[model samples]
Target: MTLSFSPSRPAYLGVVRVSAWYDLVVTAGFATPWSYALLHGGLSSVGDALGLGVLPALDPIQTLYANLMGSVVVVWALLRLVRPLAVHGLFDGAARSLFAMWQAYALAHGAMKLLWVFLAVEVGFGLAQLLPWWPSRSNEVEPALQGR
Candidate 1:
């Protein structure tokens, strides 16, 4: 149970890329207002069908926030997807941790149970990227810059 906080491990690059790909795939639909509207409708239908309450109709502010978040995430995802570095895993992991925290808070406050699906994925990816994939060795770890 030795935790390697070192993001300089080469193996971490794979984790970064995978996380980025997940973001791209999942959030792409939210990147634009039009697309988000469509996605919201689709999600609402799915939720209703599953007996989970539908997503609330997006107000202007909610739409704006969703679009902004999606845009930023898509760009960030593209960076790692194209040129993943070990350090990217560290930052992505941190971001996932924050997202999971907020999602949990929302769930606790009575947000959609469907969110649990997202939370699970977030936790999975966050832990995968944050945890040490291999045993740490001071003698073996590369310099931070070298990991780039």
Candidate 2:
């Protein structure tokens, strides 16, 4: 008897694509300054009814960082959406893993610490992209010889 196992690509790709679209939408928060209200009001807040993170100081550097990250997120999503099959899962996993690690490091160093929720989400996405491709002994098998 021989055992076989095959995982569905559509389910995994569906998760990847949906997550990418979610990234695009959520990333818009980083692209604009108005969304910074979540810093104080918590990441769940919808409006900037509270004070902005860039007010009395106009910290251009912080603004630049936010826009840059947002742009990268948009591009990343577009890539996965455009080339779901051709796009390598490992590449997406590695990129997101690095991004998540960097975000974790920044948080440890007290940079945008209030955005911990975002960090958690990033880590989740990274894992989601990786788990499907992660190597495992369970996936390996040796063929049996006939008439041995």
Candidate 3:
């Protein structure tokens, strides 16, 4: 059997939901001061174990920024998790693209290699959600019936 690259709405929405879950799992710790303290230690340990340099000691300003970012992202993720709409995928993909770009910039400016892991995920999900999905035959049938 041949693999099909045709866009499937159900599959696309599934990807959106999966991406949302990933964000929730990864960033939930950053959404609150208490959780971020624990997360900071965990991440620092992982970095040291992987031979990446340890993360710097957490500062109040840094924690504040992290919390703000986490709060926004968690809300966005929840929206996608609840609705899993194609439009949500589009917006999420755009945000992921931006995040990946910033991650790359930080890496270039001496950010830890550990960030590469997050960057890879951001790029993967961004592409999966943002790739063009136009129908091959607009006149043939309704989109819902076209198996798209």
Best by lDDT: 1
Q: Of the pair 2 and 3, which is ahead by lDDT?
A: 3
TM-score of each: 0.86, 0.64, 0.85
What candidate 3 gets wrong by more than 4 Å, as runs, is 1-8, 133-148
Error of 3 at 83 (Å): 1.1
lDDT of 2 by residue, 1-148 (tens): 2222212344656666877788888776676666643432444232233321212233667767777888787888888788664134446667778877887887676554445666687778677766654455223211100101
So what's the TM-score on candidate 1? 0.86
lDDT of 2 at 71: 76
Best model per TM-score: 1
Worst 10 residues of 2 by lDDT: 139-148
lDDT of 3 by residue, 1-148 (tens): 2224323446777888999999999999999999999999998899889987667899999899999999999999999898666667767888999999999998898887899999999999998877734334333224433333
How many clashes does each candidate structure show, in the order listed? 0, 0, 2
RMSD of 3: 4.0
- lDDT of all predictions, in order shown? 0.81, 0.58, 0.80
